[model samples]
Target: MSKQSASKSNIPLNPLAFIRKYDELWRRMLFLIGALIVYRLGSHIPVPGMNPERLAQFFDGSQNTFLGMFNMFSGGALERMSIMALGIMPYISASIVVQMMSTVVPSLEALKKEGETGRRTLNKYTRQGTLALAFVQAVGMSAGLISGGLTLTSGLGFYIPAVTSLVAGAMFLMWLGEQITERGIGNGISMLIFASIVSSAPGMITQAFTDNLNLIVILLFAVLGLAVTAAIVYIERAQRRVPVNYAQKQQEGRKVYAQQQSHLPLKLNMAGVIPAIFASSLLLLPATMGQWAGTSANPTTLQSIAQNISLVLQPGSPLYLLLFAVFIIFFCYFYTALMFNPSEVAENLKRSGAYIPGIRPGQQTKRYLDFVLNRLTFIGAIYMTIICLMPMVIQTSFGVSFQLGGASLLIMVVVLMDFIAQVQAHLMTHQYHDQTLIKSSK
Candidate 1:
């Protein structure tokens, strides 16, 4: 056999071997776990000056609304009015705004093209935006609590301290997420969100059981959950492979090489779970406003407006579902466009002496890629809409209190897949390194 075949055969198949050889990977994994633990612990630390009973009552009333959804994402932090009540949402909101702005604002767009330096600048802006948004949200939350008589004191002193605590909590969580990204495995923000969802699972399940849901209904939901999970795994793995052929080339000191063939694999759902999250956040806005307005003691024009919106945008409402579907589709395409630039991919392929079979090397290839991506994205959007909306339909129809809904399930499954992929990548790199060293020593 050839040396290549021998080296390939020698690659370690046991995970234990990779672990024994790569201490750094283990350290990174540990660091990620530690960071997530810190986040989970912080989620239980209540903010100062809140009356727990009243706060719990408020959350109970809003439990079926968008606030409940927000609370779920925060791992019940909002329900407890915890220090991490804001969660990582403000950061996500800021990111969405900055990404959208980068498209419309010339300076931001230019910065997007500036590579690492531009990326750093954009990150700085996003951090600043996060702080500002957190502060504003904290203030609003404090005011809402005070208005709802959920605060211990009714004075300026209470507002000042409570808002500060909440804002600081959010900023700290943001810092933790950044640290995780820099020092650990996978996407930190996504991992934190994933952790939140998973951590809340037991409580949600227990709640479902206590709600007196029929055993058969519960069993059915479990079956549906498994089915949805299987579907998600299949869809997430689906990709459209575009064939490329690299022309033969020769180095001045080496023999000419034969033409190489490769394929660019574009995921069916390029946006992943992001569009669903963005859409949920957007839909929750009106619901939040409605909650705050309708909860006031006296009825006002704003309260009436909020009530009307609340009625129209309830979870299972036709209008709510329609708007949700629209937002998901918009963000799926918008985020896909932001993340994968066909022109840039085409340029890189051209520079690397690669061309798609039966297509020209540059603009034509870009157009073709765009066409394919658009079609795939449309299908993906439909898939996401169905997956996300299915839970609401189930809850409405079955009156079941099951919490493992589509968005939660999607986030959990996708993040787990991503985590496994990262570990596999690290293991592969370690194996390759080992193989290279063996070859060099020989």
Candidate 2:
């Protein structure tokens, strides 16, 4: 054999190493795929008393803008008024509420400090809140459907059974999401959302092609989406590291003691997509009110006020985008405040005998942290605002109804990259010995 080929052959083909790497590479993926299948199955199980024909016609002429697009992110389940129609929104809402409540509610606050045991307690409460919210939402939807005459039109005996079915269906989806998280690769909740985004993709593609959309326009959409996805990946991984100098130490017993110099990695966007989500959910309240009763979607008020709110809440309206950007910015700061505490950090540093250079021990360190955090947050909030609003502005300017799928695509790409990165990390570490073997043979 040639020298190079002989060297390659001498490298170990170790079964144990190969199996470990292979398992690391594929196990999570297997879980994710399996969970996604279950989520899709749940999406199609229709809520009782939903009029398929009416639902179809409503969607056919609808604006399909902000709120409608959000619904699509939950899959057609929202339109179908299926049980999972509520999707993960309620769970997310309950989680936010519980977390917020934990701060205000002393009992809950105590539980939060209990570590693993406290976490389990919080999880239990979150689940309870999810179920309660689902039941209420399902009832509201049931009443809305029946009052709108959508249920009775199908003549299938609507009211009581429909509410029951819808609630049960939503709960089923919740269970499915939890199962996926337990046994899947990606976050189970995120996978459910991801499934919704993907389910809508093929339809959008078909619509674009069959409608004879401008090729340049379609290409622009693709390129913009790719760019946004790349940007999201970059921003998600971005962090500001603050250096810490530990107090120098001498030998103790048989071991040499040395200073540990390190830095804290504070993520640029510590709150992740959570703030955007919370803001969006809160904004939907007005639309839900309008849907509940309407001459205008807003509550009956002074003519100008009602008109103004209706205009603002309208999908793709300038007012809606404005409100969305403001809300995202607000929530970004709010969530950031909730997530990080300068005082706590300073206290930890004091306990650990570490200090930032040129900073005093306690209050000064806290002040410095707050100053740095505020600056980072300013940049982060602006970045978030631009990302959230850019797609809306583009679609509106171009008169393109379907382009904002780019935002959803961006989220999916980032999330998928995170999952892939975790897998690759496991594989690389597991294959280190194999690489060493190959190197030595050379």
Candidate 3:
């Protein structure tokens, strides 16, 4: 082998090493850490007119319901009735709606094909949707606060400020997430969610101690978390490789180049945590409105229907679990379909003179790709469903308060894995630049 190849092989693969060597990577890491700190700090700033004592009491009684899970997502902001109590869910819900619509709506689909300009247009629509949803949710939450006597005053005096604060807070967080995506590592929204989940760790630990959980049980829970995380790492890394062969071509007079071979790596879980995240956000929105209605002193017919729906879908209900699984499965297929087009892939491959082993280049290849993707998506959906349901099942069966549920755990693991992968990619690029510099000097 050449000296260049030998030196390239000798380069270290450790991300930490590159982090120490490269200023840019460390700068991005620091920026991410600083942004998350800002988010945590904002969670402590309560909304005006909130009765802190009553709010605390209210959330204390709601430790096992949908409120509890929602509170966890907000990093205790909801429990405190803070300015950021709404968290990022409004934005997520709006995004889901916009994306799903884009798939079916002719005008939206046209914009989607228009590329970057279309992306900005779609994003503008999503922001508008976020504002609308946030306003409606804020109004409901304000009513609940008044009904529960968690507010300092009644009527429009409290209502106006509360709604304004909540909506503004949600928009601010949306902007912060955008900044993080532009300037930091990993996805901005996922990182924010991850930060929220992790920020609650100290409180969860205190709760465990207060409950007098035994060392053995604590160890068991730790083991369980590790096992789940390990499983996610394994499955997230798994891929199906489809072998492809490129046809040989004549370069000049009598010189024919050798045929080339490569493989397309189709992930076992192409949708990743998106399906679960989307399903959770969609499921929780109704429950939030229902919880607000249930707190009302006098509910209207619409509120009554919402409350009944909430009651039926209360955290551990069989219907909740079944619907969660079904939505996850649907989104797994839906998101996968949105991201990958077998016809497009087949067309590209045919143009490039590449064909999958034993498969024709055009329509047959598309069919084969579709068959493989459907099977993969089916397995992925089932795997995500089982992993997401583990915490609920454990809590219901053993009467244990597993505050860090399976869904949150799965998201954290997946986000961290993706972050690390991005870091490694950065390091690889740096290595390539260094190799080029070395060769140019030689």
Candidate 4:
């Protein structure tokens, strides 16, 4: 027993040793958790017009509609009408506009290739754009208040106060997101969306339960969700490793053809959830009009217009299903084009003395890479479109509503998954260092 105890003691007691016997995931987990907490807290904080008693009545009197869903993505701040109610949406809008402009505006296109300084300049412009958009939307909301989104007991006095408060809140929220990006683990804006989704999960589950879904159906979706998540994980990790060969160097008049190996790894879903996000953001214009039509137009005319919009553009509606599919496909290609250039890649590879096996270098190699990417992108587009659109379409078809958002929920999930993998990679490297030091000490 004494011998056994001694052996056990010698086996190493620090569990971190066993895990750091390769990777330390705890530190990264801690940072991610801490950042998420800050975002979640902000979501519940209320805005200026939050009439305590009336707030519940307002939500109870009406279904939490799409804006309610938007509020959910904002972590309930929208309902409370908090400073963060506008969330970081204005920034996302600004980014989209800037990204599109960078491709079209000749001067902006030149600036893109100028490296870090140009990037910094673009960043400044993006910030300017964010502020501009926030201000405009703030005024719009203020006007909406005057037009009756809110009741002004003080008449014209309300406009100045409301707009000021709202705009200030938006800028504050923007600051918060920037802080998270600087100090937090995952992308700050993405983590905000993650917090919102997580905050709302319990309510959604309880609602489903109370709706009296059959035990089997409840269990089925639960299992299905798990399965789908696992599939996403697998697909995201899948990579096509194209082998590259490098010729050997000659020294002192002796030539040795040395073969080196590297892989041009192409991810199965390379464009990522960005395609879905872009598509969803574009679709929101029509959807926003539908919302406005609901609130402002004459009842009958509103009904017809809303129906028409829904038919053509609403998520899960028939025309919506068609357009959504096409949009996913289009943006998959479009964003891929924006971010990557096979010709540039081939040029760089040739300069570096790397060549794919059985492939000619330069433009020919570029063409081959392009061909491969097209097929991979098609698979990715199909997978994304199906996973994202299915839940909403099926639910809408069955007269059951669920919160299935392309930009908010699905994108958050995918981004979070990627973030976790990156964290784990860092942890693994740290553990490897610790292990090497330990071995040297022993």
Best model per lDDT: 3
Using lDDT as the yardstick, the better of models 1 and 4 is 1
Q: Of the candidates numbered 3 and 4, which has the greater lDDT value?
A: 3
Q: If scored against the real structure, what TM-score would every candidate get? A: 0.93, 0.84, 0.93, 0.83
Considering TM-score, where higher is better, how would the candidates rank from best to worst?
A: 3, 1, 2, 4
- Candidate 2, residues 322-406, lDDT tens digits: the string is 8888887887787888789899899999998999999998999999999999988888888878877787778777777663443
lDDT of 1 by residue, 1-442 (tens): 7887665555554466555778878888999999998998898898888898887788777766777777888988988889899888889889989999999999999999999999999999999999999998888777777777888896788878888889999999899989988899988888999998888888888989889988998898889889999999999999999999999999777989999999999999999989988887787765775776576777578777887888789877799889999999999999999989999999999999999999999999999999999999999999998888898798889876545679789888998999899999988988788888667545
lDDT by residue (tens digit), candidate 3, 100-123: 999999999999889999999999
Best of the two (1, 3) by lDDT: 3
How many clashing pairs does model 2 include? 2
Please give the CA lDDT of all the candidate structures: 0.87, 0.72, 0.88, 0.68
Show where candidate 1 strays beyond 4 Å.
1-20, 250-255
- What C-alpha root-mean-square deviation, in Å, does candidate 3 show against the real structure? 4.0
TM-score of 1: 0.93
lDDT of 3: 0.88
Q: What is the lDDT of residue 331 in candidate 2?
A: 76
User: Which has the better lDDT: candidate 1, or candidate 2?
Assistant: 1
Candidate 4: where are CA atoms >4 Å away? 1-34, 50-64, 145-149, 152-156, 252-257, 289-314, 405-409, 432-442
Ranking by lDDT: 3, 1, 2, 4
